[model samples]
Target: MSDAVEGGARRRGRDETEEERADRMWQELIQEVRVAQMGVQILFGFLLTVVFTEKYDDLTNTDQTIYLVTVVLGACATGALIGPVSLHRIVSGRRVKPQAVRLASRLTLLGLALLLATTTASLLLILRVATHNGFVPYLVAGVVGWYLLCWLVLPLWTRYRHTSE
Candidate 1:
């Protein structure tokens, strides 16, 4: 096994060139984005019809506001997740895959954050509507905490523990 060192820093295991690495990263990113994009699009589609539902008028003003905010968040998440595809389409053959990949990765991260917010808001609204209990906020908070642990904390911890920079 050979460990290549560059610029006084240890190189990662992959031996691919920049372009090859970018190509591989782009494919992986797109595959991940496809799954997220589909879910976001479906959630957004459902959100779009919420306002027209007869029960919509029965919601309290607070709940209605939550729904509106959730819809907007979902829309933003959808856009960010889909942005990479458009970015790739416009930048193809431009010899900017590396830069595009970085930008797309940022967009994907932003999309995930937005998705977290959208999901949290939706969960809050649903729980408030379904339970009508005083513990709804606590329940939502607990679930959001679980999501933060599962989606963000664990991944960052694993990366920090297992990888060197």
Candidate 2:
């Protein structure tokens, strides 16, 4: 029989240590979070300003409710997207980069879901108010389908197609 270290065990390709993997994953996670953070921040800022606009008073009760829901969803998305930064700050120098990256990834995913809801609600409210047509819901549904295709379906497809067990 050959030696355990040299023979039967499968050899890793690059022999990338855990620390190196964590470092690379953290960098990629941070870059992804940055893109999400910018978008959520801008959308949240715009949502906040809407209530102070002159047209705010003219909104019907249903539209106002939709606006409120949209704003709240946006706020939650903002919090979730920003969570990774705070997490990193608190966990810095703890040698738990892998755990941190996993947690941050979860938060980012939650933020994206909230963002999807916020965008859908905002679109529904705006289109209803603008068009006053029976087809508003249909239009909103179409847009939501598009968002799903872009945000969830494609990622999942790529993951399943390319990833190995």
Q: Rate residue 112 of model 1 by lDDT.
A: 92
Model 1: clashing residue pairs?
Answer: none
Among all candidates shown, the one with the greatest TM-score: 1
Residue range 1-165, candidate 2, lDDT tens digits: 122355766543445678887888889988998998888889889989999999999999999999999999999999999999999999999989989989989999999999899889988988998998999999999999999999999999998997553
The predictions' CA RMSDs to the true structure, in order, are 2.3, 4.2
For the record, the alpha-carbon RMSD of candidate 1 to the native fold, in angstroms, is 2.3
Cα deviation of 100 in candidate 1 (Å)?
A: 0.2
Top of the candidates by lDDT: 1
In model 1, which regions exceed 4 Å deviation? 1-12
Could you tell me every candidate's TM-score relative to the true structure? 0.92, 0.90
